[model samples]
Target: MNHGIEKKARIVGLFLFIGIVTGIFSIAPAIDSTNYLTEVNTNSNQVITAAIFQFTMSLIYLGIAILLYPIVKRYSQSLSIGFLSFRVIAVSLSIVGTILMLSILTLSENYVDVSSNNLLEIETLGNILKSSRDYANHVFMILALCTGNVMLYLVFIKSNLIPKWISFWGITGAVLSIVASGLVLFREIDIITVEYMVLNAPTAILELVLGIWLMLKGFDKRILKADEYENPDSCTLGTIHNG
Candidate 1:
């Protein structure tokens, strides 16, 4: 283990999470208007600020993935690489959503400011962009976030590199996230529903603890060495069972 990178990974993971929370909530009250045209006309500055925050959050995610990859690869090389890919997809989707959001701003400036009712087609296009933004966000959170976490936590568990409790909590959260996303996708339940929050809260808390644990404790040398073997799983499971 590169002690330097380990320390950096934990710190980066912590800030990466903070940035995500801050970036998303920064514009919530000021710019998150339901009426898109009204939002564009009245709070354009806030809307732009919100988009910037979102873009920054996506960038932070990239950093998190890169920082964690080295640590995770020792556990499962394939999953470590897959983690990067999943996060890349998630980040790309987030950027796409940001683009759609800015496009709505463009629509408002070009058409809504001029004539809202005369051209039903323009209104339709704006609505489509808005819908696309929402869907992109959904896919990012559902497919990318859940899948990535599942992969990470499973490797952590298998390698015995982190506390089993943390890994289990994270795995539970990943499972719930999958279920919550399925509910939203199929049932069309609102994303803001209690169900989603309930599912996400555990993972959110787990991440905070994980960051702290990694910073203070780092990965166990014994487990890290244990993972050098091709069949770390059998050894890890046997230890757990004997314990």
Candidate 2:
């Protein structure tokens, strides 16, 4: 519940996520011996490794979320906004996104063995992954809009939990996510498409910034106090006698 501790955890989680993204985009690209599919195949092991690392960092982020939600909810004095409300939505969508991403990774991993393995199975799995990715991205962007930007922003702009600029960035990030995912879905770029790849870093960077900010500074004190009251144990009931 301490803002200081929450900030530290956020920073740690952010740095971990940064490391994972860097490993996937930067380090992974350099490892490929061939430049043809260099973007796709280079340092694949590193990319997979990065995915695993990101997954681990997500778990840490989840922990931070768990600790901070009650504080924000209680302090804010309103369940309409803050950590708990936003997180309930954010986490649900994040789970969907994570699952889709994992499916995509698994299918891509097996694609290399198509000739030696079952071609039909590979194709089927690829379709499933692509569909999941498209759908998940759509839902994820929506979640950002509902939870990160709309709900959290109400608290930030009003409560001063975080700077206005940070809230602005969160809103911007939400919009960008929707747009990027739109380009991928409507334009059919979710699977190795150039448009999706082009928009990837910008969308990711925005989310990175937003995520870092949230981890560093949580919701208002009013929300945190409210959370305590909602716990039931914190409440004291007066004894009554039938007169």
Candidate 3:
């Protein structure tokens, strides 16, 4: 198998696994909602479980992304820098996002458990939930935007390891993510609808496509070693090889 293809397959596997785990966590919230209506205390445990599951999955995904960056870095100079930089940003944002999600889940579960909520107390809780969600979405959206641009630039300008169109799709997905996040934080739109359609699903699909392509085809080792016909940059193909 091509080296890139193998890496892509691993990434696809990781993302798919994340999707499945997240789906399971999503269901827990619905179940907890039902428990809320039925006056059951089971929701707390469920929320805790969901939070743990989500955090674990996110950490695993970040870990895999971090590990892969260095391996891929060696194949192409331009791609290496971009990948490493992205890994740093993604890891940071993702950690913060996970914290927010977990905090929201904790707060929501507690709210559901409370028997009586004063108007002032309810308002405070609402603010907390809203703030947590908003922060998570904002940070994640920015990371997505940066990731998309970096991927596009690396593929289109720095290296030709993967097809140009795949990177383009990544860019599109990133744009949608930004829009979706903005709507969530600024437009008072339905969270589930915008997140599922415009951000999460598309980003996952794009990542899968790109990952598979990379693992199967690997990177173009020569792209990093090439020189521009005129006004070559120091990181240009030829310079990368010698440097």
Best by lDDT: 1
lDDT of 3 by residue, 1-243 (tens): 233334554565556456455635733443224223222234556655655775665566555555455434444656656655665565566556556555555555566667584535854765665456445545453555456345544544444555677767666777666666666657566555545465756666776665555445545544533422232543354345434
lDDT of 2 by residue, 1-243 (tens): 334434544664465366446434422232222321223343456546644654554555455456444334433546434555555555465556556555555555566656856866866766665566446535453445345445545555665666677667666655655666665567555434465555455545655665665555544445444543575443222111111
Lowest lDDT sum, 10 consecutive residues, model 3, at 31-40
Query: TM-score per candidate, in order?
Result: 0.82, 0.56, 0.62
Ranking 2 against 3 by lDDT, winner: 3
Error of 2 at 53 (Å): 2.3
In candidate 2, how many Å is residue 111 off?
5.0
lDDT of 1 by residue, 27-89 (tens): 433223566666585777877888888888888777878777766776689988887888888
The C-alpha stretches of model 1 lying farther than 4 A from their native spots are 26-32, 116-119, 225-243
Q: How close is each model in CA RMSD to the real structure?
A: 6.5, 7.8, 6.3
Q: Which stretch of 10 consecutive residues in model 1 shows the poorest summed lDDT?
A: 24-33
Q: 195 in model 3: Cα distance from truth in Å?
A: 8.1
Q: lDDT per prediction?
A: 0.71, 0.51, 0.53
